[model samples]
Target: MRPLAPSFAALACLALFSAPALAHFQEVIPSADVLPEGGEVNIDMVFTHPFEGGPVMEMKKPVKMGVFKAGTTTDLLPRIKQSEIDGKTTWSLETELVEPGASIFYVEPQPYWEPAEGKYIIHYAKVVVDNYASGEGWDELVGLPVEIQPLTRPTGLWAGNVFSGVVLKEGNPVPFAEIEVEFINDASITAPNDAFITQVIKADANGTFTYAMPRAGWWGFAALVEGDEPMSSPEGKDVPVELGALMWVKTTDMSGK
Candidate 1:
């Protein structure tokens, strides 16, 4: 009898990418960041296949990374909990049966980042994320409440949504405020979602407003201009506006409240 060898595609995928490049029980990449106080963290994990020669291969596969509030069995917020961990800050999602590729994780900003940002720590271990050509993989987990607690301070936000905010001009709320936002994947700039953005929203009669949001990404407030003019608020001129999809901007003094 003859022993089986390997194929070009099989070898190309490499076992490392399929397994998060982590050891039998160790972390490969531990990331952290500076976050606002009292914010939640939403983690986004992406998988890529690295090659021995040439560049790393990007694989768009069905991988799940879930988060559970310190202690509970309820469905995690992002509900991608394919990996099970010991406590709140400890977890390992699997890319099992993966075709030898790499994975990326982005812990989005909440109201703050102290929870899992630079303060907490994470260890890596591989788990199996099953896949089926048929769509029967749905958990049918439904709305069963399992009593999950919110992390005193969690990390990550909606994967690619933008947080809306407003500025004012001459003691008046600026309607057509132009803002710049950058979409990022892990550390790379993702394809922009400007096409999905809506027109400027207005403040209510009370000088208050609710803003719209784009999916989720690394966002930076570019400018606050209305119809080609920059806006000014009593607080000061254009200030640094960095918001995640779950944050809100307050324009109090300019609203004449």
Candidate 2:
């Protein structure tokens, strides 16, 4: 029994070190994924480890922020309000819906310097809200440097439904791209291990991937790839830039009558 205990301790140490690295996600969650009829939506912008739900990183004013609807894009940067999440800088925005259609909100954040990784990260994050039961144009592409065009309608989804998307970079499909998926822990779900915290999947040769939502909540999918060129870090050394195509989708529970 004594020898077994020591052997178990050694295995635990190895498990801790051998687990795959956890991935970070840029969250653009809204107060509601579906806009009420003629109502407003509150949006929260933050850079964080979503599943772990702590150590929120500082996010600067976005390089670009806007809403796309009915084939026109409106700049909403001035409406964004700044606040702190866990003492780290965060942002929010509010917008009212005037018509029935799809509303796509996007943010191109300034390149965030990650000291631990010795690189810069720029995750172009976006979320879609269906307005008044009209699912119009939920799949519109905003022409981001990297983006996920949802094959599945991003809003008004139900738990256990499968969500699918194509990972695109510069309007071209990225074959077999690596994607990381995590759900916001607002429900306080405890992960049994590190692997349960962040789920990973890969796009197929055509840059498409699918994930089934096991629970009703907000889920983020981030397709990650390296940029073509390096950028200068704050310390004046050139560092690799990681471009992430991130999207947030919400799912609901089936109503019990």
Candidate 3:
């Protein structure tokens, strides 16, 4: 005799447990974190699961992109060019850095609809590039709606260094905000389990959090907060929106000559 079919609830539970929980990271990575002599800086922006390093999501043209340096913000939206990775849409920009200070590159992408979560995602991502290793302007704020203000210098760090930041929403500290950390896996390392993919932490009462980098690579810190109002989904339904303020920092190992 044939076995009885499983109930709908049982199948749903199985599917939920079987799927891996991979956190989404909006990556705005520069070719070099510290340009000693001030040269061209190539920036790549992608929306994907950074730890797994694949299954890239299509990123629409960003609404705004620019650089903040020396108390000024320069628009770089027109310089951004469309690209594709694994058949998914991405973006890149190249700009020459002539100054001797830190340049904070930022991008505000269009809202992406995620049907599975029943919410839209809008990640305001940014990174810092220190020209001539001047070290100044590394702590300047880009004034994003939801932003991670770095307490530690965002560039020229050794691999084992601790990176700290404060979560702010609309220029105000967001106490106990949740932050997700992930490394840009180069396919050289493998996670032992799904739980090891994304590292989760929460800010303190003052909205500050810290994490240490174990290996030499780029790491992203995303401070997540829910939007004030719901947005219209593709299906014409009202859904919640997830606002992620992401920042990327690069670390290198101390090598002997």
Candidate 4:
């Protein structure tokens, strides 16, 4: 179904609307696994928020992995997109990190496809049922995983333009390495990362910045090239991320300025 490069036309008018495909994501899956026997567990799929006041998480599908074997039937493998930026709406699947031993992972599903409820909450979330259910890992007495719930459907945030910045290298200021911005809200920042607040801005002094998310639904933003220092996670898996995954931007006329 590859027919969208007419320059994308504002993501093909938000993919021919009618609504029913909301999403928000964040699934790292390691849950303290120390499987030394056949040793092979290193899932790294991140996109977190709740206001990444010290951020760094950029996603564009390529973190493929879905191995649910034992009798076989769940091996949705696909990964390898490399890089993406400039009027976004990406997905290039064909991944397989191959480690089909003690499996149970279904990573990769959130890039326009919602229907959990309606109204947009976190960017794109889907992974409940104990996160994937298996042995409960590292011995918590086994019985903990499925609890990924937050998809109040009704998406279509940036019907036209979006892009925000702050990622330097030779000029400094590269905190968390991922600045894909373009918001429009005009000095009213407060939607830290319910993932779809649309626009919110701040950053200056050669670091550069911009914002204008005056009202849109699905949105995107990620930063933290390890600059501006601040990072944490390890308190109960430290889950408090609001924004999930809504990265797509660059469509002009932003309504008026």
Against the reference, the lDDT scores of all candidates come to 0.26, 0.90, 0.94, 0.34
RMSD per candidate (Å) reads: 22.3, 3.8, 2.1, 20.0
Predicted structure 2, TM vs. truth: 0.91
Cα distance off (Å), candidate 4, residue 184: 13
Better of 2 and 3 by TM-score: 3
Cα-based lDDT at residue 13, candidate 3: 97
Provide the TM-score for each candidate, comma-separated: 0.21, 0.91, 0.95, 0.22
lDDT of 3 by residue, 163-224 (tens): 99999999999999999999999999999988889999999999999999999999999999
The positional error of residue 67 in candidate 4, measured at the CA in angstroms, is 11
Q: What is the lDDT of residue 196 in candidate 2?
A: 92
> Weakest 10 consecutive residues, lDDT, candidate 2?
1-10
Candidate 3: deviation at residue 82, Å? 0.7
Clashes per prediction?
Answer: 27, 0, 0, 50
lDDT of 2 by residue, 1-257 (tens): 54545678789888877866657788898888777675889999999988888669899999999998888999999989999977889999988988998889999999998886889999999999888868789999988999999999998889999999999999999999999999988746999887798899999999999999999888999999999999998899999999999999988889820
Q: What is candidate 3's CA lDDT for residue 176? A: 95
The 10-residue segment of model 1 with minimum total lDDT is 144-153
Model 2: per-residue Cα lDDT at residue 92: 95
Candidate 4, TM-score vs. the true structure? 0.22
Q: Identify the leading candidate in terms of lDDT.
A: 3
lDDT of 4 by residue, 77-105 (tens): 44423333233323332323233233334
